[model samples]
Target chain A: MTTAKRDTYTPETLLTVAVRIFNERGYDGTSMEHLSRAAGISKSSIYHHVAGKEELLRRAVSRALDALFAILDEPDAGRGRAVERVEYVTRRTVGVLMAELPYVTLLLRVRGNTTTERWALERRREFDQRVADLLKAAAAEGDLRADVDTRLATRLLFGMVNSLVEWYRPQPGGGYEGEQVAEAVVRMAFDGLRSGG
Target chain B: MTTAKRDTYTPETLLTVAVRIFNERGYDGTSMEHLSRAAGISKSSIYHHVAGKEELLRRAVSRALDALFAILDEPDAGRGRAVERVEYVTRRTVGVLMAELPYVTLLLRVRGNTTTERWALERRREFDQRVADLLKAAAAEGDLRADVDTRLATRLLFGMVNSLVEWYRPQPGGGYEGEQVAEAVVRMAFDGLRSGG
Candidate 1:
């Protein structure tokens, strides 16, 4: 018997399937045929919802980029001390990554082989630069350590955060939540792995 | 006139060229023809050195995996206090990642769509588990913080380390070296981002 889940598919639903396929098969290796087979939809139906694979990629990466860019505009990220602002952005970035894990995973893996991929890479760099600026200001304020380079610290901090995509799988009734993970990230970034000072 | 570089293309040398292409084009997206064109050699010549693209992938990933596994067997990593051992592994991991950047980059991005990809992933997980065991022992020894889960901390630590693949480029006389980066990583990870902590 056919699954009832296949009865109806919107562009948004089609995108969810496409992104999963894209993640499984490297985006360069995936095609419309793969999406159609995964979604249990016809190629015409897939095209009817979206222009093509590139459009699906654009839509997927945009979801991740939009969520990330939004974090920079939040009052907490802008109205506080640079160090605090960096912390705020770091926490929210982790939250967004956990929330939008698949899309961001795809975003992080883009190789700049296509126009859509190149655009995603450029936007990601812009986001990283904005956060790097916050890190620079924190260093200038003497709130951050002098020994570690601000640019290197910024990369490491986000690297730790962006890594959630690699292994974090959400559970319906799991013990860990995004906020708790964010708290741990902030503590680790600010205080470190060792207990106490 | 042909460059002197083209004069010799041993399997090891050809594997380097193939790995770069595998990284640029996703492994599944790459083929014998792609490797041939990239290496300035014919498909037959490429085959003469290595069996196929998968063999090249195997060789490259084995290089990365071998380097990483060797770290666990190092005297410093084996004979220290749990905390110190973890630190040693962490520092050496960053060094190995830098020295084998392209190979590890391809290793990290493997999607597990093929048997070789799946094997690479399994070996990576095995390595992560070994490191995680070290982190767990450190926590049990009361050297690490109790607040953060050991598993979570292990993931974050490596996440920060693994991220070097995204942006690190080696220079013959670069301002930053792997050991320096490793020191900063250990500092940020053990001490943190705030000043005078």
Candidate 2:
């Protein structure tokens, strides 16, 4: 393995590399050796920064979960009418997913085979339920359409948002900004796709 | 492993078990031994049904890809106006997703670690592009809103459709059938979530 540059290897930096590998090889398929090889550092050196692979998985998922849960606490998320609050959460959640793309990608792919994954899945459900409550309230307040089920609506809305991880790639020369993507998402989710209907 | 139920194994039956394990352990992490253990059959029996693990992956993804591609050839998809055709594809795509849930779910999660995965990814891209073409045509006809980018809208639309694999569990007692889920998806995607404009 190429171990030429070894001056800067913090937990965060190591995490950036680890998350990429985790997404590529998968969390279960990845190992310390893979990390060491990819990081260009010895396994012992990697151990100095974090406990082991599970810690890396935990940290990566925690970062994603923290960002997602934090959106619920934002001022707009908390202060708005239920419908607006749902929109706010939807937009901000897109922002978080784009900003923390790799970490969140890893987060979404967890299959709950391990304790950490189970915890992540549970926390994810909690987040979904919290957002579902906003949708439910919005429906009750006559803000949202009455025809669609609130629970199903909530999943589909976030499904659109969460689907960002699959195809979104940040443009290098400022082609598509996060706010622009967020705007499109909010518009499409709220407005029917048909024009001038 | 318990090998009690060996009399009723078919390629289709074995695929159901293998896909579940593939989803749980992931494609790269899972091995023939895992399949054997999960299916309560020897590795030899698994080989008899399918060539190996990659064959199973190919079969599962082919089932999904076939269903998706078949949507493009439907009379509504080809004959209707672009906007209606888009809606037609969207509604039918959701049905295909629900009908072939596990197969499509496995298809979506492949990460291109192996040749089979790379092929699956390429085929998936082809499917996405075909749907995207319909979206572009709809936008050209001024049916879809002009504000949102057509490509982004396509992704978001299918994003909603694809997200079905995450949380949709079929109800046993005639609750929330596939058609109901498909209807809700079409409504949510086309109509703005907010009450009447």
Interface RMSD of each: 1.3, 1.2
- lDDT of each residue in B1-197, candidate 2, tens digit only: 48546547999988999999999877877899999999888889888888899999999999999999999998999987898888899999999998898999999988898899999999998988888898889888888877868877888888999999988877789657888889888878887788886
Estimated TM-score for each candidate: 0.88, 0.89
Fraction of native contacts (fnat) of each candidate: 0.74, 0.83
Please give the CA lDDT of all the candidate structures: 0.88, 0.88
Model 2 stretches with alpha carbons more than 4 Å out: A4-8, A113-115, B4-8, B40-49, B113-115
Q: Write the per-residue lDDT of candidate 1 for residues A1-197, one digit (tens) a residue.
A: 23334448988888899999999887988888788888987788887888899999999999999999999999899887899999999999999999999999999989898999999999999999998999899889999887869888888998999888878999889857888899988988877888767
lDDT of 1 by residue, B1-197 (tens): 22223536898889888888988877877888777778887778777787788888889999999999999988999886798999999999999999999999999988788899899999999999999999899988898888868888888998999989977889889657888899988888877888875
Query: RMSD per prediction, one decimal?
Result: 3.3, 2.6
- Tell me how many clashing residue pairs each candidate has: 0, 3
CAPRI class assigned to model 1: medium
